[model samples]
Target chain A: METKDIYREIINEHNLHPSHHGEISNPTYEMDGVNPSCGDKIKLQFKVDDSGIIEDAVFSGSGCAVSQASCDIMLDLVIGKSREESERITEAFMRMIKGEASDEELEILEEAEALADIAHMPARVKCAVLGWRTMEKIFKENRQ
Target chain B: MTNIFKNDFEILHDDKYIYFDNAATTQRPKQVINAVSEFYRTINSNPLRGLYKWSVKSTAAYENARSKVAEFIGAEDSSEIIFTRNSTESINLIAHSWGLSNIKEGDNITVTILEHHSNLLPWQMVSRVTGASLTFIECSSDGEISDEEILNKIPSNTKLVSAAEISNVLGVRLPIEKISKRAHEVGAVMVVDGAQSAPHKPVDVKALGADFFVFSGHKVMAPMGIGVLYGKLSLLESMPPFLLGGEMIESVSRYDAVFAPVPEKFEAGTVNAAGAVGLAAAIDYVENIGFDIISQREEKLCRLMIEGIKTIPFTKYFGSRIPETHSGIVTFNIEGCHPHDVSSILDTENICIRAGQHCAQPLHEHLGIPASARASMYFYNDESEVERFLEALKKVRSWLGYGN
Candidate 1:
């Protein structure tokens, strides 16, 4: 698919059935991500087992369809992964979003690689990263 | 309103250009552009520092611009006008100098709920630094605050009342004269953020009884990185200097330094001389056209937009509908569509409008909305452009699947 096609696809998928579009009933960690420039906000929460593995994650917020849907897709990507592995996934995602990834790094992105085209839209880059950044903060604090 | 000089502005070439984002910035007139260009071509020299001929000419041009701005705003003396980067830095200068010097522990400063973050955040930071308390006078449903509400919030220790003369988001023209009178009665100095007002109408700082007035030049069809800070000479003399550099000092010893006069003391270091000249030319352009006529033209456009937008179903408008009591800003949101999406659709038509919180997030929170789309007008905008905007907005509504 062309870059615009991929972007349109991501926008369409997120708008139709947003992932992690609801709150987590009981979770170990929660954090709010706010993009002050445009007033986009997202709240992410995760449930971790005693062994420090990510059991589940969810998010809720009011923003552009891009941001809300990005959070939804981000939740699906990090679930069922270990805390360390999730952090690595977030770092890899940032590289892809910023368009700084190598060919090998592109392979690592796997399913989330559809969002690499967002790098061209500078204004919407923050929208694509809001969810991943929030998850990174939650895991960073919980790990320590 | 005349077309004799219309061709002078490059942005006016295409009649199809719908520039509704005037509150953000305006297109420079030919005279202002020529003045800036002439500075680099003919008289390119630093002012106040060098005694050479080019320097003298540059200094004279800069000072002449200051005098013109002082007269334009009805300041008592040209010496009272201080130059800064923009309204943000101008307000910051007051917060650091006058605010710190006057406001003490337990001192109260009252502001209105409709202030731009430029006017609100400076006082908030001042309160945090000085231990003084900051209180916001609530705005009405129409975005107007009454004199009674202002009086009720004025405590004995209220040091200042900083307000926006015209709200960038609400398009509501505040009763600054009445508010200033009430503030003075309680011994609080009144500061007006004229960033939105100065561009739309004639501003008389003396007539408004404001102790300090600040506005950015870019919003007035001048260049960016230049702004004016008008203060009473007494107040400017009493406050500490905002920045320390070469030009703002009278003499510097090993240990202590004597500062220059009021305006010079506030204007530290090399100023934006070219930008100041361009600003003066902008003022000259507006004056030649007459503010009353300019304001009248804008009011007509505002009414046209209001009527046009109201006809669209599910279009909820915010702010004052009264023409006389409003600026040129029109903020609204469709029921189902987000402001960003509306902005994207409008961008397709080349009809520029601002979307999102407009740097007034707390006000958005107060209004119980996440964000809004604002269509701010200027004198250059006309009824036909507003019609085009309304047409585009209708298309945006349907495309967003709003209003079945």
Candidate 2:
């Protein structure tokens, strides 16, 4: 419940030096993630090859620490995985943040486990979920 | 002895409820609360419906509240006072009933950029239906409002000009009286959103010379579900009823029915009479304290709040830095923190301030910022609360891991 617990040292580090914090050279798919109430907006771009392996991923936008850090950590996890595996990881992260991830799922959630504490923050759930939601949209759109 | 005013409201005694969101809605006093309870307990009958004793007494209570509101706002006739749910509803009644009926193609509906969405959106609807284009008056960066914006924006094609007496977001008072004069000179009706002004200062709609004036009862120490809209007698007569139902009719039939006059015509269905009565009690409480004292106390508190924010090096004020221009509101943002983050940290300290755009997107867009944090005060708040708020605000950047 303490405010300090919510904004950990790691979140600050990730926010300051966000991974893939710029646009992709030529993204196969990209989409916008917006939380209008909080004014957090993000544009997610990814380069997935014909084999469905995500070759590159980058995110660019403005938001609070939780949101920026969430997207950065997320891009770092999903970049080398196949689009199929990326979708699975996105699912587990969503489940983890909602306090529903099993032990096996948390093990796969990777560095995103640092943010599982976001489950306790009711107001911040949206910030933690923005990047994962964006990833889900990209994969869903590609399936079509 | 100076803190005696805090005793009127039970909520102020609780050490945790550091309520600084007075601009959104104010905390009700015990007297206002008891008046509402007494109405439900003793005189719980529909007004203007039956000739039974309870009904007559209820009608008397309701009508008396109307007169109190009329007197409170300095309306010449009680009939000018029409009750609605809140300021939003009151303004909507004006737009739907008056704007729809009167506005025509090629006419212009003038409004300011700083209007709350309640004040801004209705005009947009009216303009859309009538083919009347909207002309927005701009405010200076320091939130200095002048009649020049109106005088320049309002052409001879303008039919009506609506503006807020004080902006809920910027916390700066607008020059409504000067704008009213200009609007009149240009043959336009002036509408004032007095939601922010009435609660902080003594409001005289007639003196302001606005055609339609509105303020919510809840923001002035009354309960919710009640608001006052004071329209010029002639203007109300010209517009049709916004809502049509039983009480607003003179005589009903299976076919066509004759409508009642003016205020009642607009106030359809069973009225919020209990809310009106509670509003009257609130007015009595405000009058007892007097506007002169209320303004002076709030002015001092606002100045202290502005000073405290200034002391924090990274804090950036959104409106006028001069405290005298503020309507007991201080909207600001931290250099390295988003407003939501700032307010979230402050909330952990039990300090309640409004974050986000404060429902004025046009104004926020004009200011070139997505959102800001607001700490609005009322007479119930004091210097100690300001100190507590400043202490919490100072920690926001640090809590978000920004360096001291």
Instruction: Give the winner by TM-score.
Output: 2
lDDT of 1 at B84: 90
Q: Estimate, for each residue in A1-144, the C-alpha lDDT of model 2 and write its tens digit.
A: 355776764457687677679986778998999987677889999888889888998999888778888899898898888988888898899889889999999999878888887787787789889989989988887793
Listed in order, the DockQ scores are 0.34, 0.56
Stretches of model 2 off by over 4 angstroms after superposition: A88-121
lDDT of 2 by residue, B1-404 (tens): 25777898888888776999999999998999999999999989999999899999999999999999999999999999999999999999999988988899989999999999999899999998999999998999887876667779988888899999999987788888888888898899999999999998888887898899999999998999999899999889888888888799899888988889988988899999999999999999999999888888888998999888888989978788788678888899998687877877788888888888788888888988877889998888888889988888888777777678
Candidates' interface RMSDs, in order? 3.5, 1.6
* Model 2 chain B worst lDDT run, 10 consecutive residues: B1-10
Candidate 1: regions farther than 4 A off: A1-8, A50-53, A81-85, A102-114, B1-6, B12-17, B397-403
lDDT values for all models: 0.84, 0.88
Instruction: Give the distance in Å from residue B10's predicted Cα in candidate 2 to where it truly belongs.
Output: 1.5
TM-score each candidate: 0.93, 0.94
* lDDT score of residue A84 within candidate 1: 82
What's the CA error at residue B273 for candidate 2, in Å?
A: 1.5
